[model samples]
Target: MTVVISAIPWLVVSLVGGAAACVPLYGGNVRRFLRSSLFVKVVMWVPLFVAFVVAVSGGLLTGLVSGVLLASIGAIEWLRRDTAGRTRWYLALFVASCAVWPISTAQLAPPLWMTYCLSSVFSDVTAFFFGRYLGRHRLPDWINRDKSWEGVLGQLLGGVLGVLVLGMIFGTAPTLLAGLVIGAASAIGDLVNSVAKRIVGIEDWGSTIPGHGGVIDRFCSLNIALAAAVLLPR
Candidate 1:
């Protein structure tokens, strides 16, 4: 609760600024923009964003609850989908990572979890926005058709920006190097998830989140980002 309270101002800034910044990307096509998946994606992601903040920054009890919920949901979905057992090994690894992440981050001081989580979420947002608007070169067809160099750059920018914003709000700064590390980890996580989905011959891990496919789909970057954050010099 305290973490959430302290981060409210930062959240508002991110949300409003993101929306306003995206106006140019629409290229004056208001109706098209409203009808696009980008709008739906933003709307769907906001609620989950709050939950992630709580899980990472809301202390031991909240972390445990979030972990249990993540593990249960993830297991159910994996079992339901992977009837052929193509993903069992990966599923075990993912579930274990999900279960452990919140508990691991519980030891971090105030705003550290916030910084890491926000960096990850911001990386996703900026990557999607830039990729949608400016992507010219597609990544390898095997890795991800939707990813691009521009989007990767956006991910790095988002990471740096997240740390800078939180630094101002909390008056406790993490080095920009931490942001870069988190960003790179996030990009790798996303790519890895994409590859796994391709190997499984599926479009998403699940359809739990409306626009975002599944819980795993939404959280892959975050889990990796937090893991990377753990290695950052505190």
Candidate 2:
């Protein structure tokens, strides 16, 4: 109840801000905007958010179990599909590091856990839009062709804003710092995941969700963000 109540204002800000930004991006074509991939992604977030709320509400053990299950699925899939032995080893290490954060963060307060998860969500959302609309300098074609510096700037902005909005729940100063750390870590996590896919010669980790490819695809940045949030001084 408390979690839902606190998230209402933040949710409204994110949705309204996202919709407003799309207006110019689509040249006022509401129909086209509604049909866009961004719109689909936004719509898909509903179920994911529900699941998140339930998982945290279930207490630490449940969150830990859920994290372990997800990590195992992602790790097995990624490792089994990749043919490159050396890179597969690196992927294993990466997956293990990613797994630790969420499992550990399960012990934290629900609001803090939610903040960690949502920071990455905000970063991902804003980066996609800003990258599409204002991106000029492209990232290396091999790692991730679509990413750009402009998108990164947008991610930083989103991360900061997300934490600020939830400032009443967590202390403002610490969360602001955590936001920056989480934002940067989120970007790195995303890039690493993209690179892993490129190496494996696959478009997505799996096809479990519509609009969002797989659990791994959707939550790639989350564990890293959780790590950042957890590491912050209480």
- Each candidate's number of clashing pairs is 0, 0
Number of colliding residue pairs in model 2? 0
RMSD of each: 2.3, 2.8
Over 73-144, each residue of candidate 2 has an lDDT whose tens digit, in order, gives: 776766566646545654564566655444555666777777767777888887887798889988786777
Off by over 4 Å in 2: 76-87, 90-98, 169-173
Error of 2 at 159 (Å): 1.7
Which candidate comes out best when scored by TM-score?
Answer: 1
TM-score for all predictions? 0.88, 0.84
Mark the regions of model 1 whose C-alpha exceeds 4 Å error after superposition. Answer: 1-3, 21-27, 56-58
Poorest lDDT segment (10 consecutive residues) of candidate 1: 1-10
lDDT of 1 by residue, 114-187 (tens): 76777788788878888988899888888888789899888888788877776667556889998888788888
